[model samples]
Target: MLLLTIDSSAGASVALTRDGAPLDAWRTEQTTSHAEVLAPAVQRMMIGAGVTGADLDGVAVGVGPGPFTGLRVGLALAHALAEAWRKPLHGICSLDSLALRATDAGVEGEFLVATDARRREVYWAQYIRDEKGSRLVRGPFGASATDLPELPAVGAGLGLYPQELRPATMDEDPSAWVPDAAELGQLAEGALVGELHGVLCQARPLYLRESDAQVPVQMRQGGS
Candidate 1:
């Protein structure tokens, strides 16, 4: 099967997998570039792999527990392509993708998979790594990373918070923080095989807190 996976929640990543092997992959840290670069990036991978929209068997997307704008851009593109091509659409949790990446990177024990959610908070999750896969142990929460309850941590971007609050054992480097597309391919496989849920409706963004737009005008006015 030919699968195209997209993740723009944390960083922009695009991957093309055939069967279970990644045929091609590309990523960019273009935070504001999703709208302009997504199509071209996907096209480059397709062209490199010598595949077309008609060749895609499915569209797998990282439906996010991420910031509103970046997450929506990737989701909208995935849905648009899926509908236009009449291909099946599958949604994968961005946090799950992070968990999968952590496991693939050899992180064991408990993990707090996280991505930078601006406003001094993070879109985060707590999971345990086992031979079977990662199991969510605590949260898919949005809160000040500093306020995060104590837990063993292994994730990217630890510097976002005070050193005292971060997981003491996890590496505190930016390089350690990016999500992997290869694991995304494996995640897509599980979803495709029905071992995981593939329904789009149920796969809604796990935004743990109320969005800025959702805040009432009074709250905005009063800084509540």
Candidate 2:
């Protein structure tokens, strides 16, 4: 299956894959520009891979534990592309993409896939790799970086708060934190190629916390 994958949960990446292997992928190093960079990045990725919208079997996306605005950009585009191509869309947790990276890099024992959720907290998921694939042993939890139990940590959360925990080997690789669209594609290629209905039927954004734009109850109650 030819799959196009997108993820903006951290930096933002677009990829093309066949079966479960990546053909080519693109990512922005500047983390804050998802809205500005995502649409064009997707276009470039497909073009570079020598594919067209019609060439895609389906779409896969990172369903985030990320900020409201950034997370939605990728999800909206995935939905639009899937609808445009008339193909199934699959959503995978963005942290799963991070965990896959760790497993691929040979991180042994269980560890945390952490990403900066801002507000001094992180979006964390725990995983252990077995022969099948990585398993989520704990969280898709959102909490203060300090609150998470100590494990070798991987992801952007460590970059943001160096004081929080012992860094995993991946912490040295800057790209480690950014969700890889290629990895997202690998995770969802099975659904795209086979029974799309049985797995993720839609590409949905996973915002684990409320939007920053939402007023706190105390602040709202005092407002005229």
Candidate 3:
């Protein structure tokens, strides 16, 4: 199956996958540039892979437990493409993608998977790695880094909260933190084949906290 996968919650990433394996991918490290980086990355991958939006069999997106802006941009684009192409779409948790990548990177023992949530907080989940795959142990919740359990840690949140959450060990530099598109596509494929259970959801941003954007005073007061 030809699939296009995208995750912009942490470090914006896009990829084209075939039958669950990645055919082409690109990721940008700038966390705030999702709107800027997303379109070109998607366009480049599809053009390089010699496919167009119409050629996609499905769209797989990382529905995020992330910051409001970056997460929304990715979901909107994925939904728009799906609607334009009249194709099926699946929404995978951004944390699941991080967990899958961490396991593949050889992180053992119980650890927390996290992403920078700004405002000195993180979106995190506890996981135990086994031969089959990662099992989500604790959360896809938002918490201050100081409140998280001290365990081995991975993802951008580690760097963001270094003074609070220490690592069990570091397999790679902290700069490598971000969701992986290949894993998201594998998850989407598993969802189709029934190898994985139902964790994916509709395209919605997991902004666990209130967005910084508040209703205008006039709107809130019903002034128009």
Candidate 4:
């Protein structure tokens, strides 16, 4: 099966795969550049891999526990591609993809996958690796550093998170911290087997908290 995976959940990523073998994968640091970079990357990946929209069997996108703007870039792109090509679209959680990347990097024991969510909070989840696979234990929630469960060999999207969230065993690789589109494709393959539901429409970006900027200011003096 040929699949295209896009992940703008943390860093922007685009990957092409055939029968689970990665044909091409591209990821770039785009702290706030998703709007400008995602599409071009998609087009470039297609060209680099010698594939076209029509050649893809499915599309896998990282639905996020991320900042609103970047998350939308990927989700919108995936939706547009799915609609245009009339192909099955799958959504994978951005945090799950990060955790998968961490595990693939040789992380053992429980893990606390985290991404910075500015304003002194982070998007985080706790997972435990088992015979089946890693399962979420803490949250897909945004929390202050104090709120996360004990970190475990933590990695993935660290700049989007707080320093205190790093575990004692942390194997920090800011580069590896971002989600892997190739891994996203692999997860999509697993989901296709009915191991997990692959609902494109129901796939919502998991923003754990509303933007801090959106919070209404309270009067210190008294009610306004």
Candidate 5:
């Protein structure tokens, strides 16, 4: 299947995949420029791959437990492309991409996937990889690092609190890990083949908490 995938859970990333394999991908760790970078990056990836939106079977996106603004930028672009092309839209948990990367890197047994949630907390999930494949066993929870169950962990969360979370492997670099659009596309392909039922979700943001932006009480009371 031909797919266009996007992720802005940690940074802006875009990819084109054919039958679950990455054809091309692009990313930047600049978290604040998702809006400025995502759409243009998608266009470039598609052009470089010599394909167009109509050539894609579907659009896949990381529905994140991430920063609200970044997540919204990704989802909005994915929604626009899916609607414009009239292709199916699939939502893969951003954490799943990290777990997939860990498994690909030969991480065995069970491990934790955590990403920076800011405000002195993390977005975390647990996964186990057996012969069958990796499966999320618990959590996509948001919590303080001190509250997380001790485990070998991966993702940007570890970079922020290396003393609190163990690294999944000696070679693992905590700061370098973030969800990728290529990985999100692979998971979406698995879902299409019925190998990953219930893993794919509706095209919506998986928010862990209320957005920081809120109307002030006086404004709500029409007293402004």
Candidate 6:
């Protein structure tokens, strides 16, 4: 199946995939520019692949435990495109994509996947890969880096708190280790094939914490 995938959990990334294999991909590590860069990145990938929304079988997105602003940018676009194209929308955990990357890179046994959650914390999960595939074993929790267990960890969290989170040998350089749309697409494909039941979810934002934005006290009290 041909799929267009997007992720803004860390930075912004988009990809075109066919039967779980990447056809083309684009990314930018500028976190704050997801709103500006994500759509164009998708357009560039689709054009490069010589396909359009109509040619896609579905849309896959990283429904993230990321900051509210970045996650909304990607999820909103994915929702709009899916609705317009009348295609199924699949949501893969952004942390799962990171685990896939580590597994593909040959990290062994159980390990942790984490990404920067800002405010000196991280969004983290544990996984183990075997003959079947990578399986989430522990968390999708949000906590300070120092609070995370000392497992060999991969993802942007390593870059932020290398001293606290042990860096997996395969992912020593975590600077560029954000969730990839292509990897997210692969996981979605696995679910479509029934190999990953319960892994894919509805196309919705997975914000693990409450939004920083809040109504003022006067507004809540009906004072206008």
Question: Pick by TM-score: which candidate is best?
Answer: 5
Cα lDDT over the full model 5: 0.90
Error of 2 at 160 (Å): 2.6
Tens-place lDDT per residue, model 3, 37-105, is 898888888888889878888999998888888889999999988988899989988888877777777
- lDDT, candidate 4, 1-224, per-residue tens: 89999888777888888776789988887668988988898898888878888898999988887888888888899889988999988888777776677677666678787777767776777877777666667667777767776655354435444455554243456424666688888777767766644323245677676654554456554557
Q: Distance (Å) between predicted and true CA of 56, model 1?
A: 1.8
lDDT of 2 by residue, 1-224 (tens): 88889988877899898988989888886667888888888888777777898888888888887889988988999899999989878788888787777888888778888888888888998887677555778668899988988888888888787887667765357324767888888878865566322334346777887787877788889955
- Ordering by lDDT: 5, 6, 3, 2, 4, 1
Q: Which regions in candidate 6 have their CA more than 4 angstroms from the true location?
A: none
Give the alpha carbon lDDT tens digit for every residue of 1-224 in model 6.
89899999888889888888999888888888988888887887788778988899999999988999999999999999999999999888988888888888898888999899999999999898887767898778899998988788888888888789888876356544789898999889888988776789778888888999999999999996
Cα RMSD (Å) per model? 4.2, 3.5, 2.0, 4.6, 1.3, 1.5
In model 2, which regions exceed 4 Å deviation?
131-133, 169-176, 190-202, 215-224
Residue 73 Cα positional deviation in candidate 1, in Å, after optimal superposition: 0.6
lDDT of 1 at 31: 80
Off by over 4 Å in 3: 168-170, 174-176
Structural similarity to truth (TM-score) of each candidate: 0.83, 0.85, 0.91, 0.83, 0.96, 0.95
Instruction: Assess each prediction's global lDDT (C-alpha) against the native.
Output: 0.72, 0.80, 0.83, 0.74, 0.90, 0.87
Between candidates 4 and 5, the one scoring higher on TM-score is 5
How well does candidate 3 score on lDDT at residue 65? Answer: 87
Q: How many backbone clashes does candidate 5 have?
A: 0
Name model 4 segments beyond 4 Å from true.
156-163, 168-176, 194-201, 212-224
